[model samples]
Target: MLEEVKNYKLKHKNLKLIPITTKNYWEIGWLELKKEQEEFVGDNFKSMAYAYATVMEGKYAKAFGIYDGDESIGFLLIGHNSYSFEGCPKTLMHSYDLWRIMIDKDYQNIGYGKDAVKLAIDYILTFPDGEEDIITTSYVEGNECAKHIYESFGFKPNGDNYEDEITLVLKVK
Candidate 1:
């Protein structure tokens, strides 16, 4: 899986999902969404904390900074077999979840979000943590931008909800 992701990085050149690290944590921490957009995606810091908690519980979770070359433009977090998480819907127990994603306000609507989605799908396809038959994600009810992006990649809502957010899934196997 690592090899596949490496090959993908070489081909893409500009856009990549670099895992969070001690050296680059500060830069990623400063990445932010627009004020109104925060309501939909929540805050990156909170997402990171959740990822950390998920991992500490002996499950799979990974967080990355979405970068274009050397610039940090967004954040992404993914988890596998995460249905055991306290609030997760039982329907997603066996899936890989694109748990969270956010592009900085400065980088929105200029294809960065679209490219990041592609990079994320490529990464998930590698099955970095473990194998899963499908990938899942969700967006808040009114977040049309997220709805369009996920749907563009063939993610269909599966008639499930986690709080106010609607669940969408893409079958990969």
Candidate 2:
């Protein structure tokens, strides 16, 4: 395991990923991204709805409000032992999935998105659901910014794609 992640901290120290709850979901719902970037990631409400549905179906999925101090600045969703669809690699089963992450328009380009990713990686290293070797995520093919941020942390495309999205994986075993 990448034990060092337990000590990970963002250069912007106030940034954090707080679990989304009824008390704060409303604030997370209000976060907005640039119009052109909307196609890259789903809105918080939709992502949360999917999280709910997946949990209802006996899967593990959780949403988090990405906060800078007390302000809700973004959203993140993570899954474990998921993606049972056709064409999914057998290797990805029983692994962690960085399902969705997004930063509000006002917070973009100030390094929060990158920092939030680091926090997400830190959380995954804690193995919230269970221990696993791989963490996976996908982005719409043209979302170069997402690709860059994920790649910066060693995620690599694994020759898999679903529709317009391409899958990337980081081996943490």
Q: Which pairs, if any, clash in model 2?
A: none
Q: Which regions of candidate 2 are displaced past 4 Å?
A: 1-9, 89-91
What are the per-residue Cα lDDT tens digits for candidate 1 across 21-64?
Answer: 87777788788888888789867778788888888989888999
Give the per-residue lDDT digits (tens) of candidate 2, residues 1-173.
34444444577888888988899988998899899998889988999998998899999998999988998889999999877888776656768989999999998898898898888888888898889988898899899999998887888898867789888888897
Q: Which stretches of candidate 1 lie over 4 Å from their true place?
A: 1-13, 85-87
Each prediction's TM-score versus the true structure: 0.89, 0.91
- Please report, in order, the local distance difference test score of every candidate based on alpha carbons: 0.83, 0.86
Name the top lDDT candidate.
Answer: 2
Model 1 scores worst on lDDT over the 10 consecutive residues at 1-10
Quality of model 2 by C-alpha lDDT: 0.86
